[model samples]
Target: MLEKLLPIQKNLNEQPQNPDSSPEESNTSPNLLESFKDDFFESYSFVNKATLILKLFILILPGVFFFMLALNDALDRKIMALEDDKNVLTDELFVYPDVQAIHTSVVLREQILKQVNEKEHYAPAMLDSIIKSLPEGVSIKNEMVQGKTASLILLSPGPLNVASFITNVLKDDFAQEVSILSANLVMTQNIYEIELVVRYR
Candidate 1:
């Protein structure tokens, strides 16, 4: 029985194996191995990309933070400097009333000088008018000006001439007030001497 079983086993083992099955199994094993290798490489590449991104973030994050910190520091310093300047200016303004007073005085002086110049410009024209208004028998002996006031000593042939001079002076637009301070009849020269004071508006 053993001998008969051995022959049967030999025959079964010797029977022609399926030639296509070996090649197909061999091809499938290699394909599966190649697919596994490709999958492993793909996973490694993804992990490498993730690691590279993490490294880049780690590298750049501190630089960005430090840059922001430096910018903030610079702004703070600039703000502090501006505040210091403002404080200094405020302190100077607080400490110096004299400077303000001097500026005010200068402005006032300029205004006064401008007014004086304007008044002086009209003086010659006013003098011409006064001279033209005088009567033929009257002449100005002496004239003095102090600020807006005028003092005139007039020599007139008669009281009428003196009165005419006063009337003419009073009629002037620039004259605020006019007064004959004194009128004296001079017998030696047969003339009337009049002292007139005129005030300008």
Candidate 2:
């Protein structure tokens, strides 16, 4: 009986697994799934693209944040510099400590110029006053003011009229010193020419 069973097992072991089958053709489900996976997913798949985009975001966000911080720092520095410059300019233009400094020649020069301009601007009134004060047959030829001094050239019919004019100038509060620069007769015009310079009071 052992001999019969041994021969039967030997026969079973010697038989082929399948007569018309091969290893390559086995498990069609697993092979088809592997092939489908290879075709659907390539080198640049959705998973790879998502990872690349995430890496780029991680790199660029820090760079942008640092860049904005640096820009804000630069703007703050610029604003501080501007404030310093503004303070310096304000001190130079508006701050005055000493009375003498305010009355310095440069400052006085501007004031004097402004005063003289104002005086000249009211020249019509001055001329009107002069015309009203003039004696008969006495007329002013030229008149001008230089700082605190005023000059007048007048034509009169006689010396008495010139004397009258000098008395009128002295009576007024406009002059402190009256100087007779020239007093002469114009023979052709039959008139007396008088040039006077007066210091303002």
Candidate 3:
């Protein structure tokens, strides 16, 4: 048996190797697959990506929890401040009327009215009363009120009678100091017009 195997091995070793044989016919396909194996592993590697995502989530979770806690604490403090303010306002409401701030507006209005009555240079009310007391057919041409002085122009049909009328008005008890500004004769209407100014004491 050893002698027969020796001859068979010697005959296998004596076979000639062909240098012109194509690599594709030999072991070409497996060599290409071996080179691409490293690239395939690099292209489809999910473990590193999964580990990176897990690390990012770990970093963000603490920040999210911290933000939530801080926001809740801030809202609690704000609510506490609002409750304190509400309690203070509720307590002040009962004692507000006795604080001397009430009735100040009424007192101020009374003071203003008193001051207006005491002032010497206010005669609009008196002038209105005087206008209402004038007799018929006695139309006033001009009426002016300034400070405490009231002036008016009296027009009548009888010419040159305005001066006498003014003199009579000055002697009346209701009339104060009177001054005749002018007495003129209008020829077209044949009337006597006189301007008189009266002062209210």
How do the candidates rank by TM-score, highest first? 1, 3, 2
- Can you give the lDDT of residue 157 in candidate 1? 89
Model 2, span 1-201: residue lDDT tens: 688788757755654566676644443343456544444346568778888999999999999999999999999999999999999997887656575675797788999899977763434544454566688889889989656667899999998998877777667676577788998899999998999886655
The TM-score of candidate 3 is 0.42
With a 3 Å backbone cut-off (N, CA, C), the pairs that clash in candidate 3 are none
TM-scores, all candidates, are 0.43, 0.38, 0.42
Q: On residues 29-70, what C-alpha lDDT tens digit does candidate 3 reach at each position? A: 325664444444366466677778899999999999999999
Off by over 4 Å in 2: 1-129
| CA RMSD of all predictions | 12.4, 15.1, 10.9
lDDT of 2: 0.76
> What is the C-alpha lDDT profile of model 1 across 134-159, one tens digit per residue?
98889999988766777899999898
Clashes (backbone N, CA, C under 3 Å), per candidate, total 0, 0, 0
lDDT: which candidate is best? 1
**Top candidate (TM-score):** 1
Where does candidate 1 clash, by residue pair? none
